[model samples]
Target chain A: MNVPLLNVSGATRRFGGLVAVNEVSFEIGPGQVCGLIGPNGAGKSTMFDLITGVRPLSSGSIHFMGRDVTQEPAHSRSPMGMSRTFQIVRLFPGMSVLENVLMGFQPKFPDGVIRSLFGIGRLGGQERDARQRAYEILDFVGLADRAGDRIDELTLGQLRLVDIGRAMAASPRFLMLDEPAAGLNDAETNNLAEMLARLKADGLSMLLVEHDIDFIMNACDKIVVMDRGTKIADDIPARVRTNDAVIAAYIGKRAHDAQH
Target chain B: MPLATKRASVWPVVAVLALGVALPFLLSGGFQLRIAMLIWIFAILSMGFNLLYGYTGQISMGQQGFYAVGAYAFALLQIKLGLSPVLAFAGAVAICAVLGLIVAYPLLRLRTHYLAMATLGFGLILNGVANRWIDFTGGTAGLTVPPLTWGGEALGRTGIYYVVLAIAGVVFLLHDFIARSHVGRALQAIRDDETAAAALGVPVRRYKLRIFVLAAAIAAVAGCCFSVVSLRVDPSLGEFHILVSMLTIAVVGGLGTRFGPLIGAAIVTILPQLLLQFGAAETLIYGAFIVLFLLFIPHGLAGLVENVRWTRKSAAPARTAATNVLEVKG
Candidate 1:
């Protein structure tokens, strides 16, 4: 009965003549673990991009904590407690692992040119606090020992965790992860599930987009099924498991392909 | 740990400053002192260019425009208005900062080659104005600036050298501080991956504009120093002659490192004079040397030093890995 922490109403995006996303509406309450499951080319990633301001929506609105933020830029959205991880694991390769997390603390610091020049005021204290917090987040993500290592030296699974840690450093109320478990092995995927559960218990709202059905089935409380840019079902996992439309659109093809 | 890092940095700067301050005394000759003064002036120019291209990843070919503006501002203040040289120099740098801010809004939006060409155009326009506006700028004949004086005594070559060294020291400290600060880290993030930096809440456009203005102001200071030491300002200061903007001391020594520009300026300034012993062949030899350096060492001497350190550190791990792989093969 509480107002959702994040609300998307009639959100739509188009590229040229093709409709990438069509009036998709969803809500995520605080501490909710929501999964966005879809077949290939179902526009899930595009929807995440639209919500995160990486790509502008053609129409509709996104609201976070009762404030309309449809027109806000990505950087402005971060201070409002919205953060996202990339599908391709984009990071500052030349920077140290600790510095990668420190980058996420940028919005928290007062970035005034004059204050920076004079080295006066609260910026000095804020910078010191931000660095300390970054180290703590690096520790939380289990990369404390590798904090001084360059990002390029990290493995794919480790890089994914770093990306998640970087987002966590922003201390977001809502985190949208784009395929966090895509290339992770069984053990790594289990570790990620544990991390996500811990984050959810801490009252973080998460929209997880993943192709790993078993991981999502275990981790997510609710599932939203999409096929060909339209939501086919939204319900608790038990109901979603037996939904005819979801079965027809996703499970049916997956089962049929598995037989061969 | 922070104090240790600070001490490590401080010692080198102190040593360099002492060397620079004692140079004129050690030489005692007028011509050599004048050349030393010139080296310091160019070092300032190269340091400014490093902030733009090396730190901020913005290709700027219009540094000469700001440089010329400072020179002309000082010339007008001292020559036509008969103002004091010290105050005029300060006024010139301030005026250049204002002009830089105005220019940055439109030009900083351009990227890579377009930005370079746009700045190149700006320099050409300033050159044209200086040449055509004969009454104000002295046209192609050039304008003479009165020598800076302290208490009715003109600053001789030694005095000028010391003055330049002092300015260079301040600029170097300022550069070092900015390069290590939050803004510098943000700029580096932007340079490495702007999209990622933006996602993390870095104001990309604003930081770019800030660097552009800062670089312009630094170049303006260098120009003022040049005018004072040489006692002249010319339209050719705005002209892109001798590949002067491209041969910036920062690029020749190392792009992003703090001390690279000073080392680069020293080499570029002294090498040409040294090569002059070969008479007319000196110009040919100088061009050939520059070509070789650019072709073989794109990152320059500072990059070479970094490469050496990296290789030494990486060798032990590499050797161990080779041996382990051979054992596995057996």
Candidate 2:
């Protein structure tokens, strides 16, 4: 569909003798929110790592936006419109909220690099624009007033939102989120879901790896389920809800009975 | 440092620079100027070292390795190649830049303590070469550097002191700019959370390598300045003692603070001489001061002055902000 924004073919990763992700393949189209869900130890995070170029795949290939990027480094991929947030909150400490987000914009090093190297180029032209845009992003992330506050002062849920803000800062065509709602409470989770929906409506593509089945079911256009490192189900929400294999593998017979 | 908090520490920096400029006139004695020059030289060294460890979160305890290489390059260039002091110092810095580049790829492949140890080992190896490579380095006997000439007359103590002061100013400006710019934030991000930084697109390895090389070159600049002042280069320059001293200056000054190196250099350089009258008590008092500073003012001397400091952001927000978004939306 429109040259699938992300095409992963036979993505596999093995740790020593342990195959963390085995021959997993999937595609996400433009403006689609694809959820990757599975039980613990199912290699959801590992799969995120491979797709984002944080870790090299043991085998297979990944293509993004119409080019093979299986060997591209994370730093390079970021400039090419790939962005991600960690399962763990990974903001730079000791910086202001705006500073962390400002990092999302590099102003293209070559723009005034000589002065930057000499310590004279304060990025006078581009920096003002960067800061203005960073402020706007801070406003969007719901931390407009907290922009000047030190990052360490924020709450856990706010930190997750900051991660989202930071990911958005890059203006990425593809965003990979690793358990964005893992530590979020009910209200925070709802806020996150709404944000995802809004991003999708804006035509941004996203890959969300999460454990909250309800949130995944609600937000994703399609869901990919894995257990024991193998992808077992890939389907739209309605069909997957009643599929016998999907129900048994994910919900389990006893849990399914309890739900019914 | 965040945007607002970074603005808070400006006064101390201004005061330091003003005092640095006025230092020569205030102290008329060559001996005292020598000590002041020493302070300035170490301050430059601290600035470089801090760029690697403080801002970038990469540790290199063997900075003396680069420093010694620069010194030797400075001396050998003038002696063997007949290059002028300016050209020789320039040559030395160039050599250091290349050396830093060559070493960074392999050395920076390591992280944390392993990187520290590798750098420490690098320093020791260079120390050995400087000591044993007698034909080139003059062994422990050292190489005597000719005084830099201005209008064919030796610049003398005062002139050289200002030279050192000028170089220190330039280095400080460079260091400060890096701290304030987007590049500075990137370095801090890499230090705070490297994986995330890479995901955010900070060329982590390249940035790490750049700082490492920048640090090496700055150390070389300090080395050339030392040769002009002391006019000597020996194995002791690259020894473990020197590395530890440089580290103390950076740590006690402040690892990542604006005025840390300068403030730290002034105190660490002045404190020992202040106690020299006590003879044996000098070492004891100096050690005690370092321990006390490290124990009490853990954020360093700069940190002690600035009350509102930046804290690295973590992934989790405070629980209080859980419904914070809803409120904002409402």
Candidate 3:
């Protein structure tokens, strides 16, 4: 499979007696827009956390770019071109959007604390470059006008876009988005889907967790369905739509009537 | 969006600097000059405290530990090792920075109240060591500091005041730069949301430690200056009362605002003198003001200014935005 961009195997997590995610495994090939969809509390977000190293798996492992990174910290993964956004829309509210994007770009530089303090580390030159990159990312996300705005000034949709902008600012090879469309309106969702299409055209791989089924159905090249933390189906959207287990677990019994 | 586009005003900062410059001239009496010098010394300490507590949102009640370390380290290096005072001060700052880095690793793992308690314990331990280490520290009696000299000539009061002013000026500029730099943004990001900051590749723990060390070094320098001013380094330098007062200065001035520490230091330092007519009731009144500030102006005086500025343009957006920012649990 040309060494999938992200590889997960036997991933499991338990909170006491509850098996939050149970032996789920999946992969996303290069340039693929993969959607992870399931009923609420089906461990979709937990899977994202595990892959990004925000949480440890009870068993199993995650490999990114052909290297085992299950034991690596979340911060360490970013410089290796891995980035993800929170389901809760976390932004540094006191900071402007530009400053938030600047943080995403900072890890790429090898500036040490002493160098940063002394301003010899291009507080002038590198900062200019960072500012330029931040502006470009903001423009790409259609937020160039509000680059100076605080998080408190953004709408829910704008906040989600800002999150995406921040995630992309790292120039990651892989992006994992958790419920990016939860509170976005239809127009906003369409805007997001368009951005995802643009990103896919640029040959970036994505694993998106969204409850917006139609958006997922239309936007994803491949869909993975999960039920009770296990992968119930993984295939092209067309085939996954008709898979009996996927329909039963996610699309409902009425979906079986239509399939028959 | 109201006034979000406006640059934070610089006039207030300039005015404060002007007031500081005018202080020595405004107060001619030696007693009042000593009071003014104490204010300046505390202002330095409070500014260092703000770097950790205000900007990074870490509550540390152990700053006096660093202060005491700076005083003793400087004194011992000068008197015992016979080093020059300047070199000793630098050594003391280095010592405090190293200690801050060491302590931060285990202590910073705790959050909020737990962190506060841990830092309080750290201060207590340092104070205890100062009290019991009679051979090295002279215990409760402490060590007398000689007047800072240049080429065997003692730097008189004027020279010393200028020296303090110059060091404080450098510290202020250093702090201002950090606040505006990418490092500052990273620290603020960590403060706002540590997990998110980490996901964004902020290296959260390292940033916290760096700030802690930097703040500690600044506090230590302030302590060196305090010893010079007092002509002694007593075990009481590391006492919990110093921690409480430094915290009160930061809180009363405004937690995260620029120039807050100076304002807070001035108020806390001067207020006690103002209340001397009330005799023993001075502590009670001072405590009452702290309570009043906390209850009525939770954001401190700086927050009050921000609120006023926020409301001047459009109260609606400002009101909602204030609540949204405050709603952040951490």
Candidate 4:
């Protein structure tokens, strides 16, 4: 496909005696939304960790935008146009939603202790520009009105959206979302799906790890089915839905037989 | 992100500065100006301390060590080398700043309580040196110096107060500007969550190192000022109790607020003087006050002020409470 944006081959991760993700392989192309889905303990989170450099793989290679990032640390990867959201929404506390997003653009902020103290070198102007852009990002995520709200003031659904808004503020060419739909109600999930559609239209590539199989089926351009640390199926949503292995993995053999 | 917050903060700073200038003239007692100087000195010292512990989230328990060194360095230079007072002050500040860098490079590598313990040890070591190194430090009896002078002229109580206030005022303004800057935002992010801050490419160690050094330098300046006012330097200045008192001011003033340190400095500095009769139980009172501030008003006086402002702003019951939450939390 189109000189894949990310190339993963035989990505494996082991925790002591446990093989968490065993030789799973996948790729996502330019402007494609790839969904990684599995039941609990299926190594979905582990795979996300490996790809984002949160944890190093026991063995495997991760190439993002053509360069290998397998050895890169988590912090270093964000500057190379890669951004991620944690499953539990780890945001900067004691900051407004707007400041939280502004923090995402910290790499762009100047490293000037003296300059900041003196209010020199267009410091105020730079912050003004960053704040303006942050507001635009908030608007893009449909949380423009909640920009001034505190972190604790927002609901769980809104907090997830704020996390996405923060992720987008980094101006990443590629984005990774870990359970963006976790703990979301039907309405919140639908809102998230719509936002993803808009993001794709904006020409941003994303890899989302999610548990809502129906939402994944609806939102992904391609789907990777993971079951117990193994890549069971990789195909378009319609085809992956009908695959016997996929049905068998989701609902055991007896349940699969009843379903057929 | 509008200037509503920025614009609103300017007036309080200006008003406070004006009060500082006018307070000396209003005082009539012989030692009243000294009390004001004490407040001014602590406010300046705690501003830097606030930047380190309050803003950067690196709680240090060894600052009194730096303060003692600063006083000793300034006192020793003037007394031993017979250097000019102003020059000695500058050299003394530089010396402690270098020490901060040396200590922070190794110590800041440890997080939270470990770093705190390392710093406390550093302070204790310096204090021990001051006590035992009799030839240089004059032992626990201390080394007395001539009165603080600028150029060749001696500064009186009023002159020193004005000079200290001017310098302290400039520092306060810088602290205000910093609290509003993007760098301030980065520090808060570092405080809130280091991993997340680094994910945004915040150069976490560099900022930590910088703030630690800055705080140390300020503590040194405070020590230097103390020697200038008292005309002596001793081991007592670097004691553990002094550091606790310093911490109390930072907490009581407000951890991260721009004006918190100054308010805390005033409360802790002045309250102890008011209760001078209870000299034996001074540490006991400090412990009680800190525990009270922590249990009931952990946010300190700054939080109290913000709450007061919020209640007043919502007198008409206008914007949602959430708006004010961010305005103050930010």
Candidate 5:
């Protein structure tokens, strides 16, 4: 009976003759962790692109917090409390971890570029505040000790945490993570799942596109399964796990591959 | 955590300031002072260039267009419009900033090489227009700017040099402030990964446009200083050679480092003057230095300092890991 935090209806993205995402519809409710699972090239990332306004929707619409945001640009979406991380970790490689996270506090710069140029705005107080917030987020993501290290010095798992830390610095109400568990060891994956659960407990909504089956199965409140740009299943994880279409789309292929 | 390290940066600022103050008096010779002044102006130019290329990672081969606009605006505003030299300088920078903003809308859409070429095209058009507009630009013969005067007394050579020095000092401080501020971090973030910056709410396109305009405005300020120093405005200020030289200064000094542009500017400005005795061989040697810097020390001289610091810091971690062994030995 409540408006979803993020709603997509018949969202489609076409690349020339190929339909990357075709008439896909889903909704992620407030404080809910919705898992988007699909085989490779099932338009999972493309769906994120449409949601974040990184790519224009060929058809249909996306509404965030019950308002139409399909026409907005990607940068504008963040101020509205929508932040995301890339499938491949996208930390600012040249910057220290603190500096990278500090960049996420951009919305707090109310005076914009003009006042900033004259040295009137963000002189000391705002910078200190941002730095404090950056460290806090780093601390939250277990990267507080490594805040001074350059991104290049970080291991892949540490870099992934840094990405999440930067995203978290934006203080988003809804976070979209594209394959956050990829390339992470089992312990790191569990660590991420625990972090996501804690974020959820704090009433943050999340849309996670991941291939880590056990991680998603254990963590997500609901799971939406996509196959070839179409939604095959959307329900609570317990029911969705038993659905025939979901099983055929997932385990059936694995079983067939096992035969080979 | 590194409060002691923070204090280290202050010494360099003090040293540069002391050097800036003492240079004019120490030089004494007019030609040497002229070279110093030129170095200051080009340093300002390269600082602007670094803001765009070094921090934001956007290359503009069309900076000379903005430079020429500044120089000509200063000269023409004084000569034709009868404005004061100082007022003309301000007006020129303002005009260039506005022009930069106007150009950014269409220009910033092109990424990397295309953006560079688009800017180059803009500069070439400016050059052609300056050459053809005889009535306005004096058709390559150029316009002579009246000596900067206040209360009917000319600034003369030394006064003009000091005026430039003061302005250049302000620009340096402003550049340093931006480099250390949240703005500098934002620009560097955009350079590192634009999409990620946007996702973090950096207003990527807007910041890009602003930096482009800001860089142009600074270049215009440098051009205004050049006009005052040379007292001449010519189409050559907007030529391809000026763009290449400015790019060279930015690269050779070290992209993005605080004092790299200033050091690069000094080397670039002094090198040709020193090589005057060697005729055209000066250009050959200049080109060779650039090649060598690019090949061996790609981060420029600033990068060399970073490497030294890195090596020193790198030793500490090794010692920390071997602390148990040291304890046993002790």
Candidate 6:
């Protein structure tokens, strides 16, 4: 009954002659928490890159909120309510944690150099608003207390949350997280799952790419399994778990496994 | 209390500016004033370098090329065209900024060490041009400018010192503002993680080119001032002499920290003259000090200050566990 928030049709990426992602198609509806699971070299991260404008698609159509954004630059797409985090945490190590989040708010600031320099007109107000929002996002992610600390001081798990807070600071309608639970412990993983659920409740759409099966199973409403850059299965979690292609892809019983 | 903190951060700058104003009187010699003026000029150049290298994380070896362009631009305008010093300085800055945009377009594409090498090659080309263009640059012999004067009075060594001091103060304030502004944050983001910053919607290449041009323009301003003070400009200004490009004043003082370049400039500029006071062994001692500084304190004196702050803060926790526990509980 709801319009899809993100629509990817016949997305194909080729690195030289080798096809990395081949005609993959999927749709993510509004407020949907979708899971994308694939083994190493399954082109999941590359797909995130393509969707976020980090990599130019060889051939594809990516529509966000019914608008074609296939050729938009990363910065432009960010303000259109699309934001993503890296597989490896990429906080500004030299800057304070709050400032790292503030970096994500770059798009909301006045783009005029004169306004930025003179701190006049709309820019000053935007800066104050951005700072307030950054702090609030940090608070939401339970990182308000650590805002003043340098990013390098935080542990890997804390840094992951900081990365999420940074994406949230952009006020994105859809958040793409790549391996958000990659380096976290059990307790931290559980906390992250809870946080993702809370964010979903707040009407935020999420595309989660993670290796932790249990975490994904608990958090995602629907699952899209990728194997060798192809969509192996797409269904609700209960149906996807019993799908043969998904099973073979995860358990290494596929013809594609022999080529590697 | 926050205002008090802000005031505390500002006082050091006020004190340093005051010291700069009083330096000529304290030294009281023509040679000393000359050396001080050179230090101030180089300090400005180092600050420009700091913006590109320290803050933006772009290693630029072509700064010397820009410096020569500025120096020659100022020199020719003053000597041949008989332009006023202020007009010549402005023309020099304008030309350098244009050159910066031209060079940065291609050079910004080169990554890391390759970028450094590309800029180095560009510097060499500029140096060669200066040497070969005999009529304009005076070849290896160089060109000279008439002494700078204001209000129908020639600026003596002491007067030049004050002028240099004033220029340095303005440049320092400009640098401070740029460093604290959104532009500074964007530059730092580009340095920290270019891909991530780009993903967050930073116009990485545009910001990089902007800073590159800004740095060049600032260097041109400094170069113009240096040419006027020395009354001479040479092809050596563009020579790409590794040491001149590697003048680690910013690194030796503190990269990315305000006033660090001045400290670096003072050490590099003043040390040789002080060594001159000691006769021929000065060069040997100078080289040794540089080697030692590079090896032992790579972060420069600024790092040492940071180290001291770190130790003091680290030590406080050990001595006040009870207070810390109470605060944590509260």
DockQ, every prediction:
0.28, 0.40, 0.37, 0.31, 0.29, 0.26
lDDT tens digits by residue: candidate 5, A5-99: 99999999998898989999999988999999987777888888899887899999999999999999998888899999888777776667787
Q: In model 6, which runs have C-alpha deviations exceeding 4 angstroms? A: A1-3, A111-115, A120-132, A254-260, B1-11, B240-246, B306-330
lDDT tens digits, residues A136-210, model 2? 887877788888777667898899888888888889998898988898889999988888888889999999998
Q: lDDT by residue for model 3 over A56-126, one digit each (tens)?
A: 88899898889999899888888899999877888776677887777898686555457766665556677
**How would you encode candidate 3's per-residue C-alpha lDDT over B43-91 as one tens digit per residue?**
8888778878777777788999999999999999999999888899999
Off by over 4 Å in 1: A120-129, A251-260, B1-11, B81-83, B242-248, B304-330
Off by over 4 Å in 4: A1-3, A115-119, A228-230, A252-260, B1-8, B79-83, B276-296, B308-330
Model 5 chain B: worst 10 consecutive residues (lDDT sum):
B1-10
Candidate 1, true inter-chain contacts retained:
0.39
Reference-based lDDT, residue A73, model 2: 93
Off by over 4 Å in 5: A117-122, A251-260, B1-15, B276-284, B306-330
lDDT of 6 by residue, B36-71 (tens): 888888888888888887777788888888888999
The per-prediction CA RMSD against the true structure, in angstroms, equals 7.2, 5.8, 4.8, 6.2, 8.0, 7.5
The best candidate in terms of TM-score: 2
The segments of candidate 3 whose C-alpha lies over 4 angstroms from its true place after superposition are A1-3, A10-19, A109-112, A118-121, A251-260, B1-29, B274-292, B304-330
Which of the predicted structures, 3 or 5, would earn the higher lDDT when compared with the native? 5
Report candidate 5's interface RMSD in Å.
5.6
Against the unseen true structure, what C-alpha lDDT does each candidate score?
Answer: 0.77, 0.81, 0.80, 0.81, 0.82, 0.79
Residues B180-289 of candidate 1: C-alpha lDDT, one tens digit per residue: 56666677676666666777888788888888888889888988888888888888787775137336465568776657777888888889899989999998998898
Q: What fraction of the genuine interface contacts, i.e. the true contacts, does candidate 2 reproduce? A: 0.65
- Model 3 has an lDDT value of 0.80
